[model samples]
Target: MNLNRFCYFLLALAAAGSLFTPHPWVMWLLLVNMLTVVVYGGDKMAARKAWRRVPEITLLMFGLVGGWPGAIAGQQLFRHKTQKQPFKAYFIVSVILNISVLLAIYQLYPFSSFFTS
Candidate 1:
């Protein structure tokens, strides 16, 4: 399959897998990521139409709250806000912060008991 299809397939598989996980947070993240993708697409369309546009802070908030995967995918697929100075810098920071928070949670609560009943 092509790159875009492959990316989408992976995302779909992740979402499906999250559905079967004991951790509710995984499902929540998948939902948030899907919403993020929609918002990013909306923002891109608005940009094209010279509309009022979605706020950058709103987009960043979505990314910070477990939607960075979708944010990255949107950036690549839509070619929106990929290289716009401080925005890109801030986006990178959000990705790093989100991952760090996940890692910290995993470290504090080890998966051995975290996912099991």
Candidate 2:
């Protein structure tokens, strides 16, 4: 499958797997964002070396899956994917989508709140 489809399928699988794991959101945010940062750096290196690059959709999908913070960091840190047409707009959409999903989860299952103490 293409990278875009793979990204979605990966997340769908993770989401389903998370059903039985406690506080999966925490794991997703921490791990995915770290992975996102590394991917951004990898993409930057690929660009400099003229090597195969990470797909733009994969980058955006990272944000869509709660990696926006890392995406922002990666952009600034690696100076990658910044000022690219359509990418910026799509990244914003992904961030919005992630936020919407977070809110929906908060309003959903009784134990979904991250702030639960």
Candidate 3:
């Protein structure tokens, strides 16, 4: 199988495994972050090789949900997509939006029912 397909398959496998775990939400976030890092690295490699690149929307969506930390780490580690136009702004916005939503959810529901279930 190709690298892209392999990466997605692993991500899907992680999600499926997380569903049966006691801490599914935590597991999902960890998986997402790790996947985000890998994806960033893959994109960097693709750029260098002149291969098809990962979509910008996919990267932004990953950060928008729960992978901002990994996104930051990937940026520093891979030195990829760090100085692009508008994309940088979009990534920052996604991080802020994700944190804002999480904070809002926490304030509204301290126990986080999603975590319990």
Candidate 4:
């Protein structure tokens, strides 16, 4: 298979694996990531069709909400938003901010709290 398809396949496998995990947030993240991928694909198609495109802010919001993995994968698979200067810069910032927030949360809360009620 091609590299893009391979990447998507890997992501799908990871998503499937998350189903058995005890952490509810893992499932949430997987769902959000899948949604992000769909949004990115839709935006790419819209751009090709000369239709109204998804806003950069919306894309960034998805990434900020823990969809960066899918966003990056979408960028590669769809060849979307990888070249725009402002969007690229903001996308990187969003990913960094998201990771930082996740790290902070992990540091502040015990690991069990993330999964336990």
What TM-score goes with each of the models? 0.76, 0.76, 0.84, 0.79
Determine the C-alpha RMSD for candidate 4 after optimal superposition of all C-alphas.
Answer: 7.9
By lDDT, the best candidate is: 3
Better of 1 and 4 by lDDT: 4
**Tens-digit per-residue lDDT, 38-94, candidate 4:** 879988998999987777888898788789999999999999999999999999999
- List, residue by residue over 10-65, the lDDT tens digit for candidate 3: 76787898899888989889998998999999999999999988778778977887
Worst-scoring 10-residue span by lDDT in model 2: 108-117
Q: What is the alpha-carbon lDDT for the whole of candidate 3?
A: 0.87
lDDT of 2 by residue, 53-83 (tens): 7789789878887889999999999999899
lDDT of each: 0.78, 0.78, 0.87, 0.81
As for candidate 1, its clashing pairs are none
Residue pairs with clashing backbones, model 2: none
lDDT of 2 at 101: 85
Stretches of model 3 off by over 4 angstroms after superposition: 1-13, 112-114
Candidate 3 vs candidate 4: the TM-score winner is 3
User: Candidate 2, residue 41: CA error in Å?
Assistant: 0.3
Model 2 has an lDDT value of 0.78
Q: Count steric clashes of candidate 4.
A: 0
